[model samples]
Target: MIIERKQYKLLEKIIFEKLVIQAPFKIPNPMPDEACFLYMLEGQINYKTENQNVSVPQNESVLLKCGNYFSQIKNDKSATLHQIIIVHFHPKILKSIYSSDLPEIFKKPSFIDDKIDLSHINNDFLIQKYIENLMFYFDNPTLVNDDILILKFKEIILLLCQTKNASTIQQILSQLFSPTSFTFKEIIENNLYSNFSLVEFANLANLSLSSFKREFKKNYSDTPANYIRNKKLEKSTELLALSEERITDIAFDCGFKNLANFSHLFNAKYNCSPSLYRLNLKDK
Candidate 1:
């Protein structure tokens, strides 16, 4: 439950926001084209990305890149009420802020790193002081003006550059200016065996579910379900024939949910149980 919410805008863009809420808070964003710096002033939160989930503790903060995100309150029995402040960085805002002089930090790096989209920032002395100073304006909302807000925004960027995670933050911020896109086939081949649903795959591809299905059909000439299942089964058979691992492990590695389902599907496709199939391969 949201007890209270306050926000300050820059040219009608939400530049900063504060929220006070009760437990059971959940936010599922399909995609975000801007970066955010979030501070947990009162309680913990679990922010999940495609690759990992992070537990953000009270008084700490995190810097997240532009990507899909799911966030929920990390419950503490004694504390049901939580407070948080988020500072947003939109491409247009960055461009407006640095129109006269672009910072070295925003320049493209010589080498790019892996596509890990989350960076946890521990609220050290400098950052903690910055947060405290900003809260004063939040307390006396009238004291805040556009110039002050812009200065504060610039202040945080400099502070982030000073932090040990500056390189990672640089990479994240760079993406805001120069966004990257993945090829459709590259997206499919990379995530085909993982546990992501079709909708999630569509979100990753930046396409609607219907369009994703259409593209899948156009490129592969088969439904996503049929193609992925057959591919998984093919890998499972190779594992069964070559490896001495447990069938359950092989099933999971190849992306089936459970042994019974794997056996049933294998039987349906091959007309033979996995156990018998393995035995026949061993005998041969």
Candidate 2:
């Protein structure tokens, strides 16, 4: 059966878009005022941020906050197609529907701390059934109208709020609707302990790679690689001097992926390997 792209204006604030993916593809999309709930009916998708990457497998779902980010989708090796159903809606609609009706448990947070926000809802059989039914409607558009679609969207939202992952989902919604502000330095300092690559950092800052580099230089007076490496090694030295932990563990805690790389950078920064540096601290 030939699958045609189908869309429905469920409400003034909600839209449903159904698409299929056969080959791998990547796209960058700025976050609209509306958050998107993506259901992977039949393929795998890798959602990448500046700091994290999450894979949504077939029959699973992931909710994306309203933020600029990138998405890559690839069909399974044995599968013939990857199907996706995305519900996009403004935060206002949720507020109008549930703000007073929802319990305190479902309320959005006033503020969220700076951290990696990429997460997915675990296996939900009910949501799976909902998406299965949604695919039927996509196939038979005549069965769907504004009222039916609105009910479907509301059902999904209420079901989501009742899931075990409700707190996380609420946090994401809070961030989407009421985002906090952070200066460049604050963003860098808070994320130093994270293992995000440079590209990821840029994405998190909502800056293009070159622009991020320019701004980072203006703020820190150093290149990103050099500044971050120095800071990581500096933190490693503090850990070495203050704790009795093994050097390899310390290396990982400082965001170094391998002992050798940590050792090399440590020697370059302090003129001694991490072990030797700790040994010196002990001698003192």
Winner by TM-score: 1
Question: What is the TM-score of each predicted model, taking all chains together?
Answer: 0.63, 0.56
List candidate 2 segments past 4 Å from native. 1-3, 11-14, 74-80, 95-106, 179-284
Error of 2 at 206 (Å): 16
Q: Model 1's lDDT to the true fold?
A: 0.80
Q: Which stretches of candidate 1 lie above 4 Å from their native place?
A: 28-31, 76-79, 181-284
Q: Over the stretch 1-284, how does candidate 1's per-residue lDDT look in tens digits?
A: 68988889998888888889876565333335678888889888777656667888888888887754445564635248889888888888999999989777777777777566778888678988988998898999989999999999999899988989988888788888876556788777755555467898798788899999999999999999899899888989999999997787677666675679899999999999988999999899
- Residues 1-284 of candidate 2: C-alpha lDDT, one tens digit per residue: 11446688733644787876553443333343446788887768777666567889887888876553445553335235777788775666666656666545335676654454555876799998888888888889888887787788788877788888877777666655564456677668856755568887887787999999999999999999999998998899889888886776677667775679899888887887778778877898
Kindly provide the TM-score of model 1 when superposed on the true structure, using C-alpha atoms: 0.63
Model 1 clashes, total count: 0
